[model samples]
Target: MNIVDLLPAILAVIVGLVVLVWSADKFVDGAVGVAKFCGMSTLLIGMVIVGFGTSAPEMVVSALSAVQGNPQLALGNAYGSNIANIALILGVTALISPILVQRSVLKKDLPLLIGVTVLSILLLLDGDVSRLDGVVFLAVFFGVMGFNIWKEKKSANKATEPAEAGELAEVSESAEKPMSLGKSIFWLVLGMGLLVASSRALVWGAVDIAHSLGVSDLLIGLTIVAIGTSLPELASSIAAARKGEDDLAVGNIIGSNLFNTLMVVGIAASISPMNQIDGEVLYRDMPLMGILTLSLLVLGFRRKGDGRINRVAGIVLLLVYVAYLTILGLKTTGVL
Candidate 1:
């Protein structure tokens, strides 16, 4: 492609990346600010809203791709995002500082993540994810989310500490400020609009970049697009790790993966049925995802007192991700 023809694609990538990061930050800040204002517990906000916010990029990209009638691309974005969230995002975050797993996450969220993964695979058994499958997935998503909220309410009631109640009351009072709900809604809408536009731009730019570079769309989707969309997860996890909120880092990654499977892929397939798994997805991508999930499970099981993912495990995860990318590159070039 000539330089002039390449201009829009190049600019699209740059602009999309910038917009994705900015929009994610705005979305998170606004959501957390509002939640704190409402006197929500940190555990509740972290489990639901923050987790959902971090995965927003993947959801938007997948939904847009599905709406654009590219089910394969949408499916790739979902599965690829899961892989990146686990291997690259968690790996990088743990490298910053080993993440600790919270008991609630281990007992509740992690199993739910595994169940969603297995359910996703089962739904694809017919070689297509029909609209009905999407409904089923979403039903499960809502059910899980509702259950978590209920659990949080129960936990809060049982929390008898005066200091804890005071802290929550203070947070709620801050949330009770006079800021217009309309303004908050506007920010939310604006951020979502930017995310949708940028996702489309990134997908289009990625397709062009792949063709120009003689790379397969699958490879592009797995590497560049996947990592770009996963930027929010990487950043959030690392920040949480630096603050020694290891549970948040681990929970964020786990929650993102769960959302990608249940919400992102579910919505995408609901809009347009995704066809059978592509050769790359079956041979390389799905296996890679399964491997990473298995690794996380093993790590969790081997946890010492604090259930931390150690530096050695972090290095191993990062190496596995790099090796997977290398394999994808080789397959794209017909060398595998």
Candidate 2:
């Protein structure tokens, strides 16, 4: 390829990275600020709103790809993103600091994550993700959210113990500072718009770059597009780690994965049924994602009290990711 022909792809990557990073910061600040403005508690905001915001990139990419009739790309993006979020994003974040897993997250959100993941896979067993499947997933998503809200309320009402009362007091204090509802809505919408626009540019650029390099769409979606869309999670988790906000890092990753599986693929399939899982994804990608999730769970269990994801775990995750990419390349080249 001519040097000049590479400019658009190169520029696309640079612009995509810039927008993704900017959007992540803006989305985090705006969502958290809006949550505080509402009567929502901090943990609720972190678990739901911030989690959803961190996943904006995957949702946009998958929905757009599905709309554009590249359903395989959509599925690959969602699956690859989940793997990247846990193995790449969380792994790197933990390497920065020993992320402390909150009891609530461990007992509540983690199970939900695992359940949703398995549920999604089961839904796809028919070889396609239909609109009906999307509806089921969305229903489950809302049910989980509702259960969380109920739990929060119940916890607040039954704060008889000193520790429980103290927790309730903190929740009440945080909810006291309400901002104008209209202003909060405005920021939420604006941040979402930026996220959508940037994701489109990123995906288009990524696709163009892949085509220019004579790479198959599947390979591009699995690697470049996947990593690009995961940029938000990486940036946010890293910042959270550096700030010693371990919950934020862990929460962001888990939240992103949940949203990617439920919202991203759910919405995409709702638009139009996604194609069957490609042979490569079925044989390689899905297994890799499962392995990564299981590995993270093991690490979390092993270091339960220590609250540390050491460099060794980080290295292992990185090595796994590298091996995954190598296998993908081999398959693409017909060498495997």
Candidate 3:
């Protein structure tokens, strides 16, 4: 492709990623600020509110794509985001700081994540996610949400004084800044607007680049669009990690994956059945997703390592992701 045609797409991706990251930070801050003002528990805010915010892009995009009859794009976006959440997002976050898994996350969240991944694969094995399948997914998603609420309550009751004090300290810190309700709400709206805008720009640029390179839309959705949409998770996770909020960093990834698997796909399929999904989804992408989930399960439960993903592990994850992308590129270019 000529430089004149290629340059704008490249610039769009760069600018989109930058803006997405900034907007996510603002979004999280405003959310946290408002939640604290309302006297919500830190655990609840982190677990439920922020988690949903980060996955909003995938949900919206998938829903619209499904309605537009581009089921592959919808399906690819969800599955591809899950893959990106684990391999690309977590890998990069761990590289920035070794992620220490919370005991609660290891015990409950990790296992649920694996189970959900397997469930998603089973649904897709028949080569379509029908409305019935979507109903099942939504059932599981709501079940998981209820379980999370129960877990949070139990944790709250059992929380030690030190942990409670730490949470309060965080709340107090936010209180010190004292964001006015109007400003907090303003940031929330503005951040969401910018998020959608940036996501569109990123997707448009990625699609343009893919078309110019003769890459199929499915592959484009899986690679460029997937990564573009996942920028929010990557940014939020890395920001949390740098601040030593280890649990939040890891939790964000887990929550986003669950949302992608259950909510995004479920809503999309229920709106308009996704039929005749590419065979690669079954034989290739689904297996890769399952394997990555299994790998995370094993890596996250290391008795010797205290559930830590070190830089070495990070590099390994990144390499696996790179290899997966390379294979996709080869296949898209008819080299495979």
**Candidate 3 runs further than 4 Å off:** 1-17, 31-47, 157-192, 202-223, 304-306
- Candidate 1 lDDT over 1-336, as tens digits, reads 787998888898888777866765554444445444554554455556657876776777778888899867777778878888888888887777877766556666777777778787777766688999989989998898898778766766566455676787887688646445566556545654565567567767877877897986767766776676777667556655676556556766777777877898888888998776676676667767776876776776644443567778888888988987887778778898
lDDT of 2 by residue, 62-113 (tens): 7888789876676777788888888777777766666766665666677778
Winner on lDDT (1 vs 3): 3
Give the residue spans of candidate 2 off by over 4 A.
1-43, 67-70, 156-222, 274-276, 302-306
TM-score per candidate, in order?
Answer: 0.75, 0.76, 0.81
Residue pairs in clash, model 2:
none
Question: Scored by CA lDDT, what does every candidate get?
Answer: 0.72, 0.71, 0.78
Q: What's the distance in Å from true for residue 4, model 1? A: 13
Q: What's the distance in Å from true for residue 83, model 3?
A: 0.7
Best candidate, TM-score-wise?
A: 3
Estimate candidate 1's alpha-carbon lDDT, on a 0 to 1 scale. 0.72
The local distance difference test score of model 2 is 0.71
Q: What is the lDDT of residue 231 in candidate 2?
A: 66
* C-alpha RMSD by candidate, in order: 4.8, 4.6, 4.2
